[model samples]
Target: MKLVGLSRQIVLSMMAIALGVTLLVILTSYAFYFLWRIYWPEQACEDSWIPTGPEWVWMIGATICGLALAVVVAVNLSRRILVPLNSVADSIRRMAQGDLDARAVAGDRSLGEASQLADDFNALANQLQRVTEEQAFWNAAIAHELRTPVTILRGRLQGLAEGVFMPDESQFRSLLAQVEGLGRLIEDLRVVSLAESGHLHLQVREANLAAEANAVVDMVGDALQARGQRAILELDTQPVRCDPVRMRQALLALLDNVRRYAVPGQVRIQSHAKNGWCELSVEDDGPGVPEDFIPHAFTAFRRAEGARSGGSGLGLAVVAAIARAHGGHAECRKAAGGGTVFTLIWPDLPETGLPGSNRSGRA
Candidate 1:
């Protein structure tokens, strides 16, 4: 009686057919009984209109054959439905048992819902695989990045303790610099994590976009001078509502990129209003990012071949995150002067307030 894997529609249709067959047999038998009684009243019994022995035998045989046909059809139907379901179940089990590659195959001409379910399952599996790979890659990259500075710090401390190196001012300063670099790397990782989780606290206010750009340029002035690089500022004086501290941090990240990779060249910092947006751009006339690497320029922990010195590969990513937090985005494009231009665009706030005015808001 248990019809495993049988769909309700199929079961109902089969039941209706069986009911119709039964009704037909009952009606035919009753009609014949009435005809016999009407045509031959002498042969008709008053007590019952049951058929004679051979006629009864033939009716019973027909009923048995019809029921047997129904049973055969039910078995075949159950097999057809259960086979695919069993296959899908097996695949799910395999995937649950750490077989990320296992997939359910919905063959051509499969039922609509079954095919859709299979496709969705495959898509989820694909995403899981991708996340797993990314997690592994990030783990290795972080380990490698941390190891170098840690080894240097350990070696310098050991040398000082063992009296193998003098604790001169220059040596102490070098040690302090290494510790600062480690601290910065740790801070960058923290910020990236917060940004990724959407938990980065922002004190948004109305600030002059041009002013923030200029401030960042001034802060990196000493580094630019040391590298023989000159920064050209093109301030448009556009006011925007944003988190000033976070925005400056993002701009500093961009400037840091120029210092690390495009030193000894002209760096341009500009702010302008365009198409209902306030844009901040930093362009440098140095070796440009490779065409293939431009697409992944803002991905966390992704580094380009030419610019791998003294960086944690999270600067541009932080820029993109901060832009997105401001209901905007970041883009990397080839500059007109044969270098790279990094642009951050934010939706323009209403011009009801003066530039650099502070209005309390949360993000």
Candidate 2:
């Protein structure tokens, strides 16, 4: 009953095929009869023109054989086509029922169309499964990340309310810091999510990459200095179209990463044009990321093992997200002097004289 449509189509096809065969047979028989009449006019005029017993037997046997062959062929062809399609339909049903792992089964002997349908269904199922799994992971991770800050805030507020801790300026400052951290985490997650979903809008304007880099460094100069990190600039004027606010956010994330992990040494920030693309990079001579973990460096919440693994691992991911939002990419590699170099590269925009063109200098 479920295959009524397919059955009707197959039946119509068989009927058309049978009609064609019947027409061909009728035409051939008429041709033969006409030729016989032309060649043997005397025989054609005979009164007794009936078939012999042997001829009747042969005609009946041939008709039966042809019908049997057609039935067998139709059954086999229908089976070959229907099986994979049924498998795909079943998989789709299961998927609609919330079984993301459901997949179509296409046997080796399946017809081309059936096999292709199965392949396409399986591909779609695979993508759905991946997206489902990722959503689940993100939900769990977000909960985990938020739990600590929420718990701390609750504990601290409870203590203050119960008079267990004094409401001193320092205590309030500590609470404020935690709140700020929580806010930053939320914002970071929002940015990453929007970028991944292709909804991160940028206020792109013609500006110099070197200028953005310089401004970010200047804004964080005090903090970097306090962390015993010396800033060195190797910047060149390279025009690009980007959101300065987002670009600065990305730069701050990079610098914050350096403050947390990089060794107390020179932090080289550079911007230049290379092969029609502008690159802004930050290099640190600290313990570099592990060779195996470099590939997943830009993945959200993924941190390398050892000393390099600390804090929420979303800074680099946010950098990558921002770069992608600007039609660019972020990359990490080993620096020449033995550390990690993080770079943001995007196609250069039309040259324009935006502000903040500072020559190479130290901070």
Candidate 3:
């Protein structure tokens, strides 16, 4: 009985109640008949031996029919509501086991409030799954990027201090370079942590997404040229409501990534408005991220499986977190021309028209 559905329980309860009422009615009728016969045969139901037993027989049969009717009505009504609940429960169970694609099997009909709840649940789960996977990749990349510099510096310093070789100027210069690399790695980690922790303050104001892209391009232009790469800026004329400082931070992180992978290549920054949201994108012309690794590229400490780069790998991770903090999302995927494309999506807003608003040149 417990294993059976709620509809069954409802139907049974309705039938039981109906049967009890019918039995009570029949008993009251028989009691009245007996009292009349005993006190005055003249008024004994207008006829002596009126066959009350036959009347009771018909009443008992009607009682059974009423119970059956109650059962049918209860079943139809309860099943309509309970089935959707069961379907949603099943879908939730499947999803809990990691089936992100699992959706509630609401039939040809909807479940009203429950239907909305199921929809919200599935959406939240899907987003959470993507974020979690991104986090893992980023953590691994950070480890990979930070480990390289620290490992190199430690190995070189040990060799020098142990007097394993003559203290030559060339070796001393190598040591100096390693120390500088380590310093850069530490700073990158610090920035990445701040962005991810959501403790960093945001000075929100109206700004142009396109201009922000151009500014990031200018800042990283020199670095790209030094590495034999070029950065091209293209911006949409649309304005957006955002923090210029935070936006630049995200852009700088992305450009840094471009420098690492697109050496001897080029990066193009483009912005446009789409479906009420402004999009800012930076595309690179490097060996595109592999089919599997693209999903994890924005994750901190994620190194392309066997991919090499200098300093720390927190650049993309920081960009993603900063974008999210500003009511936007950062995404990276395989791009045309066999490279990666990263896009930032945010709500479109009018510029605040404030003076000296640009903060990209601050650092």
TM-score, every prediction: 0.79, 0.81, 0.53
lDDT of each: 0.78, 0.79, 0.70
Candidate that would win on TM-score: 2
What TM-score would candidate 1 get against the native? Answer: 0.79
Instruction: Mark the 10 consecutive residues where model 1 has the least summed lDDT.
Output: 350-359
Which of candidates 2 and 3 is the stronger one according to lDDT?
Answer: 2
**Candidate 1 RMSD computed on C-alpha atoms after optimal superposition onto the true structure:** 5.7
Alpha-carbon runs more than 4 Å astray in model 2 = 1-61, 108-110, 307-310, 350-363
Highest-scoring model, lDDT: 2
lDDT for 79 (candidate 2)? 79
1-363 in candidate 1: lDDT tens per residue? 654322444767588668867876788778767887788788676555666764687588768867876777777666655555666788789988999888877643334455556677878889888888988987898898899889998999999999988999988998899898888788778777776777666666678878877788888999987888899999887676778787898999998888888848898888888787778889999688888999999998888885757888888988988887666789999887789999999777542332322245433
| Residue 318 miss distance in model 1 (angstroms) | 1.5
- Candidate 2 per-residue C-alpha lDDT over 66-96 given as tens digits, one digit per residue, 9 for 90 to 100: 6876787688777778788899999899999
lDDT of 3: 0.70
